[model samples]
Target: PVAAASIGQVYKAVLRADASPTGERMTVAVKCQRPNILETVTLDLLTIRGVVDFFCTVPGEGNKKLRQDAQGLLAVLDLAATRFLEELDYLQEAANGARFEREMNAVPVMRDVVKVPSVLLDYSSRYVITQEWVEGVKLTDLEGDPKYANEEGAALRADVVRKLLNAYMVQFLETGFLHADPHPGNFLIQPDGRLCIMDYGMMTEILPDQRLAFVEYMAHLTAGQYSKTLDDLVTLGFVSEELAKDPAKREVVGPVLAQTLSALYAEGGGLDKKVEILDQQAQSRIGEIGDKLEELSKEYPITLPPYFILILRAFGTLEGLGLSTNSDFAILEECFPYIARRLLSDDSPRMRSALRTFIYGGGDRLNVAKVEDLTRGFGSFTNAMEAERKVAVTGEGSLAVRSSATPSGQLDAATKELLELMFAPEGNYVQELIIEEAVRAVDSLSRDALVQVWQRLPGAPPGAL
Candidate 1:
């Protein structure tokens, strides 16, 4: 038994002869919460917003970015809240363990290779989990294990890694739920070639749409449509409306993301000998993207949904752990089987629809109505430009006046009033749009007096910039 986390620690133990649930003494691992952790954790959860703010100040590239993107910050806090609450419930964790085991065992490819320790139901409680002590080798230390150093053992290790990745991919691509934390400590290699996955305290469940969006994201990348991939990313909550709609900022983001994705999957750093190569190469690449994203985050409202971030965390953790094994793990290849399986099945209507839209490009089938609308917009723009030229040449104010119901003086006064109301902390305006438009006018139009007032004010809307 070996591990420690924010909530608990694991220890090697043996059941007493008379206390055994099986009526025989046996080795077990006791997972118990830290002393008085619950009350403190609950207290901390109470101040979780401050916890989010604290993370924003934790000397990282995304600190300023996190502070600026309020929605993204909220998403982070939400994920943290869910994780902490789930981890605090030992009973919920026990249930998650059983569910995970069933999910794995239900899939034929994973049934034999994937394993979870049996819970000693009689010994478990609200603060403790007693499970069979598993004897398995650590992944990093597997290189030195005499029994697994040979070619045969290497194949077995590779197979195990494949199954592990596929199992998790299924959890992500098909099931919409996954083990949120899968760091090296939670995994082990059994003597008889089984992959033992432990710990179930943190489970993340995503919506079906999010799962389909994830698949769409992958399909775009596979199809070599980086721009479309980035577009899909915006829809999936990685890029925000502000960022996607801004050409200059999108230029800053697009290449960084494309390069990062390309480099991550590029030949040298998967789950093989190239793990070292990728580990070295990707560090700087990812850091560069993080820096750019963080800096841009101040000016553009960028956000990553919590589920997407959690999925990314799982993959990153697996990638880091796979690096230690010195084997090229084909994580992408493993995903193909299941994704293909889902697409071909009649039972999965969602997958079939997603396949048509994503894989076969069917959902985007040409529409006469959309074309007509585009044509109409073009005609309107053309007519408006000609009308503008005529008005400019004729020196006419009547046409422009007809477009506005409010007089210029009244509109200006109203805008000024709105701007003032927005900056006043106790103003309490419910129209979010008013503050946004007023701030945009004041900030962009260089209304010097309004600018002075805004400068004097302490706060603005989240995406005012």
Candidate 2:
């Protein structure tokens, strides 16, 4: 078998030249659905539903709200089951693969770095899918492979992970179509160093507004703004809007949610260590919070949206892979550049507001330190600015411009792309921010100069200035 999954097993094969679309023999993986999987899955879901229904039928006043919460869970389970059933349809999987390829190619950076196998729709059916064979190993196996044990291999691992993370960000924030199953086995690292994503059976879609809210949510969470993060949670359909609006419920939910996420984003640990920490907390502080939320839900009706479950599963699996690839991996850290790019490029009013909030502190003061940190890792930031400056002054070729005072730097294609976005006509918002800061600084200097001159005047009263 080429591969095995819960509902199917894949077998390797070579299509006959006469039957192949290319008119040449081609290697392929034929995935066949397991016999009786549909009936088995349906029965399993019914069993689970019966158990829940049993609880809902119990006689008690408290069971009333419990029934409501259970119904919500059942609804989500039904949605998930529907998605699982669709996976048995190889035709849909073929379409998903095609769509994924199209969307990834639309992003300039991803076009070359990511690879998706072509689906042979002619030979595919409801039970079997024939796809182009990818010659690669599971992404997690890279760490243990002898070829990747050296410094160069380490760099390769990091680069591939970064690209994969950015691709997922584009899927969630830009395309709104997400490849929901992101377990280690779903990704393969080709010998040529390109990443091949597989198994598009489980997928989800985020609405336009939900994607924007997700971006806003990530921005606020990364900024350590817990209150705003909680607000975004409601917007993204995690917490109930009614509970979020009530100041009393907000008081209870806000701290608990922040504490849970704080453990998730806590410093000094990779994803593995963070999981351990969360497990420990689940027995103590978080364990207690869980009990409190359960009681609170009786009256407030807290709920989880089905899409949130898929998003969590996708990111959680990715974070695990990041941990395996790099010991210092942190999802927020790896996700920052992509998030910043979105904030810089999106022209919506909400995005503009978020950009300002991220770059400016209270009293409308520019956070220069934060801005520098954000752009410091951008390889072409200094090079692009310097090259443009010299070209403007000497009317020379930008590429030929270099300085002995600065180290030699090559242009980074990704940063160069982001620079275009930041300098575009729609990017005047960023320019306005810089101008505001410069004006504020000049005004402050002039006031200080006047005060100094007044204080130094002859016969000036003590502290009069």
Q: Following a full C-alpha superposition, what root-mean-square deviation does model 1 have from the true structure?
A: 25.0
Best prediction by lDDT = 2
- Model 2's TM-score against the true structure: 0.82
What is each predicted model's overall lDDT from 0 to 1?
0.62, 0.74
lDDT of 2 at 419: 63
lDDT of 1 by residue, 184-300 (tens): 667777655456788888888878877777776765564445666777887787777767888877777776676656555644455444455446544776556667777886665
Clashes of each: 5, 0
For model 1, the stretches where C-alpha displacement exceeds 4 angstroms are: 1-27, 39-66, 69-74, 143-156, 241-260, 266-300, 326-334, 345-350, 353-465
Candidate 2 off by > 4 Å? 16-18, 64-69, 140-159, 268-297, 326-328, 377-409, 414-422, 425-427, 452-465
Best by TM-score: 2
lDDT of 2: 0.74
Q: How large is the C-alpha RMSD of every model relative to the true structure?
A: 25.0, 6.6
Give the TM-score of each candidate: 0.59, 0.82
TM-score of 1: 0.59
Q: Write the per-residue lDDT of candidate 2 for residues 133-166, one digit (tens) a residue.
A: 9988787677677977877777666665665787
